[model samples]
Target: MKAKLGPAKGKVSDLAQQHGDKIQHGLDRAAKAVDEKTKGKYSDRIQSGTGKAKDAMERLAHQEGTGPGPGAGPDAGGGTPNGPRPPVS
Candidate 1:
């Protein structure tokens, strides 16, 4: 059966906006695995592709066509997630 793009797109956009950082993290992890499996043969390509994906996610999350809501990203002035560490020694 043919799927409707309208509802799907809206859902995806909402997800992207809500969990953009988490989504980007998963993409980075997948890219790392692929690069490792390829023994660095596709390192450059993988990095480029992962970067593009993160950029697209960011755009979706920060689009704010209707105005600002929650999830203002890192620049919200609250600092990074989980607070800071002990300077990593």
Candidate 2:
């Protein structure tokens, strides 16, 4: 059985979709602040992490399920109780 998303997850997914641009702006500002505080010492790493975060947010906002991210979809992962899940083996 597919695991149904809880109310909180549903709300988060809706918020993510609605405020994705604002969220991305916040991420950029945070990354800039961190880079400034480090005086460019960790600029590369900070930028990389920021890019990844933005991509993740975009994906979550676009996910076609009740929640965010990859495993939040009904067909994505095993969340059923006492159900047999396929092992990689």
TM-score of each: 0.60, 0.65
lDDT of 1 by residue, 1-89 (tens): 22555456556767887888789778878988888889889777887787767767766665434334578665552212343222100
CA displacement after TM-score superposition, residue 75 of candidate 1 (Å) = 21
Q: On residues 1-89, what C-alpha lDDT tens digit does candidate 2 reach at each position?
A: 23555656556767888999899888888888888788889877887787777666766666545544655556652222333322111
The RMSD of every model to the true structure, in order and in angstroms, is: 8.9, 12.0
Off by over 4 Å in 1: 1-7, 64-89
Q: Would you give me the overall lDDT of model 1?
A: 0.64
Q: Which portions of model 2 miss their true places by more than 4 Å?
A: 1-5, 67-89
Q: Give the distance in Å from residue 2's predicted Cα in candidate 2 to where it truly belongs.
A: 7.7
The 0-to-1 C-alpha lDDT of every candidate, in the order given, reads: 0.64, 0.65
